[model samples]
Target: MRLSAEQISHIRAVIHECDPEARIYLFGSRVDDHKKGGDIDLLIFSKHLTERDKRRIRLRLYDRLGPQRIDIIIARDLSRPFVRLAYAEGVEL
Candidate 1:
């Protein structure tokens, strides 16, 4: 994965602060070490997190990680095709 240990730690901390039971995954180009210059792709599974909570999480991440592209998918339905793909391909963090 492209993320540093500190980055991962910060991400986990921020997410857990909002939803302690949330599951986090890193997917897309960031998951491939050979890839370059891709945004951080996160697939988060949390039943309690709303759209506002998702926005707050993203903003907090930006505050700590700087102004960069971070694509986040707050997954509630595991049945969605995209969510299924993400979960299958993603690396759990």
Candidate 2:
């Protein structure tokens, strides 16, 4: 799925509002123009994300997007080992 510039901007804005220090990235088929995909994939990195925070973020995104399919992978900032593996193995959006 290709994200429009406006869609990207809206996503970034919502992410920043949720966690200013968070690092937001896009990956998977959305990044690969040649591939066919069904949903938008996002990797969110933030040391401050608790379970409550995750729920809130998810709800907020759903409210803003309204039925648009989204796959959010949340990780901590210090989880570099896992992040690096994903970076190398995952498709970049």
Candidate 3:
């Protein structure tokens, strides 16, 4: 995985602050060792996440993780096929 221990820790902490039961996954290019310079892709699973919740979690994560391209997929927002694949293949953080 592309993330360091500290990065994962921060992400987990931020997500848990938003929802303690949230399930976080690290996927896409960041999960594969062979890839390089990919944005952070995260699949967050929680019960009944609203737009407000998404925004809050996003802002908090960016604030803690710094300014970078981060792609987040809430479980209920799993519309695309690739996102499902990502959830299946993604490493849980």
Best by TM-score: 1
Better of 1 and 2 by TM-score: 1
User: Considering TM-score, which of the candidate structures 1 and 3 is the better prediction for this target?
Assistant: 1
Model 1 CA lDDT for position 78: 88
| Candidate 3 segments exceeding 4 Å error | 76-80
Residue 18 in model 2: shift from native, Å? 1.8
C-alpha TM-scores of all predictions: 0.97, 0.75, 0.87
Q: lDDT tens digits, residues 1-93, model 1?
A: 999999999999999999999999999999999989999999999999989998999999999999889889998878899999999999999
On residues 31-73, what C-alpha lDDT tens digit does candidate 3 reach at each position?
9888888898889988767678888888888998899788888
Which is the leading candidate under lDDT? 1
| Steric clash pairs (candidate 2) | none
Off by over 4 Å in 1: none
> By summed lDDT, which 10 consecutive residues of candidate 2 come out lowest?
84-93
